[model samples]
Target: MMCFCASAKNNDIIDVTRIQHYDTILKKLLYFIDYSKKYTIDDINDTLFSYTANTSPFNQKKLDANYFIKLTLANTGQQDSFLLYTGKAQRYKMYMCDSTGKKILLKNQVTKFSPGLFTNIPYAQIALKKGEQKVFYIALEINFYNWYLFDPVILRTADHAYFSFLHLLQPSRIYMAITIFFMGIMFCMFAYTFALFIRNPLWEYLHYSVAIFIFMVYFGLRLLNIFHFGSLYFLFYDLRYQGLQLLGHMLILLFILSFLKTKEKMPAFHKQVKALIYLQLIFLVVNLPLTYTNTYNYAANIAFDIMRVLGLLYSIYVSIYLIAKNKKKEARYLGAGSLLSIFMACLALYVDRWGNFDELLLRYSGISVLIFMAGVMSQMTLFLLALSYRLRMQEANRIRAVEQLQLENDRKELEKYKAIIDARDSERTRISQEIHDDIGSGLTSIRLLSEIAKVKNSESDKKELEKISATSNVLMDKMNEIIWTLNSRNDTLLNLITYLRHQIVEFFEPSNIILEINLPENVHDAPLSGNVRRNIILSVKEALHNIVKHSQASLVSVNFSFDKVFIISIKDNGVGFLHDKITDHTNGLRNMKERLTSIGGSCSISSNGGTNIELIIPLNTYPV
Candidate 1:
């Protein structure tokens, strides 16, 4: 709305005609330093006021002191009112004087004037007629804590000033819009990372989310500082820049530590980063006191600048180490992102420091701020990628572990099956050998006796034929015993007991020995292997045969019971034999002992007035 190309000389009289619509009058004004803070309008004289060639006349000055400025205006055009604006100040007083140096208008304790919508500045309105001149005196005070490096004073026609303020707001509005967009993206990333932390409970996700939150708070305050929002103006301005920067750097350091698992993977580097973080915190705490007291402010700022640069460089170096030395896939993305962010951050800092050469560059090209935001966004995106990659790798490792465990189980199962098959083959070979040795020899003897009987046909031959009939019956009984042992269905302890009871009843029926059976009502019916069952049955049969042939017992008792083992006791009231007198030819006792031992069982024989044979079968020795 207003042009800013107008120029004026450093003279006491500012010709209003040369001021097209709006122009800075900083160079045309005379200034005086008030070290004692006792200066009044009456104390100000032409001799005390001095002109400076510096564009920013207040630069590098102590903000605690009062500054007095004088401007004289001459109206060479028609009658008009103009606005005298100071860009920013804590407080100021304006005095309007005539050519005689007598005050005509006095405004006391003026803080700010809003000449246009969204534009609030310290200003004074001066009225001038054709061929009229006025001298204005301004006493400016600045707060030490809220000092600016440059202060501009501008003069413009009232109507033009209003429109010029609107024109100046255009770039700020664009920048604010972009900032809001960036904040939105940051908020989304914060929510995403926070959600991830909630799900996985990993330190990296939590640290990243907190860092994003800090970034949001810093940027939000920055937005408030830019807009100079009503009540929070001082609060936003005070915390917007250096203090938040220190806090953000600390948070970023924490995020880096967690994201890289530095404590576990890089212990030495972890300690170095931790010390750097502590130093940043120390600087932040020290900076507050120095800034508030306006003591050592420049030195503190310089120190903070150096620390920030070093911290950023160290972070970049760590990222490079992870990428190159550690050879982490995720680190490559992180390193690339960090490099881009650091480069953009340095570029933004450079632009901010030097772009002050042009007022438009300082006001309109918020490109520096945008570039810095782009850097943050890029870093955040790559960090998310790194996190995703890490999670995927962890999931893949879990799956592989599960597959390995399953493979181990399958291998064990295959070995178990092989053992079972080998045991079955050994049992079959033993059965075949027994059939060949026992049954084959007996059948050959019967065939030879039948042939001899057919040739002789005498009484002796007939008697031999009857012997052949008895031998056939014993062979049939032995064949039935082998078949029963081979049957898998009889591989239970209950089945073995049932078959033994039937045989004991039949054996005693032909003898005068009274057999009394005692068996438990409740049997566990535990499983027994074929080898175990066959050995147990054969041992019991041998004991019974011994009882019948030699014991000469009038009464016999068989008792079956179970505890941790199966127990079978056979007691007889008979003429018991002495173990010392029994010869080595007593093969029945030796065979029974050997058979029981093969199945992890034991047999014991004891004699007092009678003989008792006991068989102990350990249940756990066989399948249960």
Candidate 2:
């Protein structure tokens, strides 16, 4: 929206006053004036200053103190409704009186400047000269109406025109009623929500405290219908209405900061917020003694304007920071609400400063509605933000409950697997002990008998006996290995690693292939469940067996390392077979991957120059 400008033929005055001296003149003129006092153009007599092309002073010869200035004002906005009544001789009555005084129009001996209903054009201007220097008190009343039931009148001087309106009873009452009733609802809602912040009772009290002051300000404005309380009602000794407005705004700022959890989001902003409130309170204390002192007002108002802009700018900065840092919904709500309120307030201040709204129809009402609506919008936005926060908390609780249920189910499944593994280990231990004591001993005895028979026999028989001894010895060794496989103590990670190292070296002792073993540091005495150790051992053994049997490798290396996860690599300088065929086998690679997966690990084989097998198992999966 653009700034409203006063349209006047004195273009030089309009330019200088509208741009530079506008706010200064308006503030000076308005601050000391009693807003409730009725006034006419004569009250601002212009006979002392003359309007001429050369801008000279008024000619004293034309001045007459006894004569009253006459001013005829017409609605420049819309004149079709009043055209018929124009150019007709008619009598008009005008008056000025406060809320308690008798009607001054009825007591007038003879009203000066009462031009008969326009027997000429729609507008007329007459200068009045009163002998006294004191400001005249009068009203400019126009006996005119529109379909909308507004009594539009205009106050006129030699230089400018202004409109006066009879205030609407319905729209004013409706807004006041809505504001009061909903404000009550807001209080209760705030109380309920505020109890949540009572852990820090200052915040709770701050919300309630601010709400009380705002309630009073709204109520006071509403009561203007019955009481002729002036605009500076709060600045007076017994009734400081502006103080209420100040307190209300300060509380609102506090409530928003606390509501959005800003203390945690931006600690420095929280400190500044406290300091600002304290500073406003100090200003209030100082203002109390200087209530009637006008000497410092110029500096004070300027300071006030500066602080308002800076404080609001600080709030905006904090909001941007919150949105960027946390991306929170509440921050967005507070930010948008604050911006709307500040903009409307600034616009209203501008209008009151330089707007000639008295010359227009329904414009002041539009501005009033904008201010009221801004408040309503801010309140509603904050309410929804609080509601949304409550909903999110409920959703989080539901998700946590679901996660807890899933964890319990997983625990039961883990216990089932553990029980089965323990039973299988016990059975394997019994079978391994039986084979080592019974079957291996029998094989050893049979081999010794065959060896003794060789000395008693002839050449051919002796050769056959020696062959039987060699066959029996080989059978005993195979049986011993089978027994150890059934009942082994290499169930922990440390024991399994040691056993695997010995077995690999022993298996390749008679072979021509060069074998290398690389064991990682910190591998010994690691915490591992028996089942996980068994799986790792089986997979490693299977891979080595494949290398020995199928792979025509000259050199082989096994390496292990572990941290968050354990890794083992078995590489061989052998002609690698196609991966598709190797992976499809039931006896070797496929079985190895199955064993690795059963223990929650993964296996992959890759080859460029030779074969490289990699196994990765989570250290956390091994019961650490």
Residues 508-622, candidate 1, lDDT per residue (tens digit)? 9988889999989998798887778878888888888888888889999999999889999999999997889876467998898889888888888999988999999988567
Give the per-residue lDDT digits (tens) of candidate 2, residues 1-624. 111122222321211112211111111111011122343333433222222231111122221122121222222232111111111122233333335533344243232232322112222222222221111123322111111111222223221111111222332444455555655665665565456446446563456445554654554453443222122332342224335656766777677676666689768878887887787777767754443344344344455555556656765665566556656676666666666666666665556444555434434233454354455446445644654575588689999999999888988888888787767767778887777678877878888888878777778898888888889877876566555555535455666677778878987899998989999777746556556766777788789888888779999998877767778899999998776675456677888889889988999999877899999887654652
lDDT of 1: 0.73
Candidate number of the best TM-score? 1
> Which regions in candidate 2 have their CA more than 4 angstroms from the true location?
1-171, 174-192, 195-240, 256-265, 292-306, 324-326, 359-366, 369-376, 379-387, 390-394, 409-624
TM-score for each model: 0.59, 0.37
Weakest 10 consecutive residues of candidate 1 by summed lDDT: 1-10
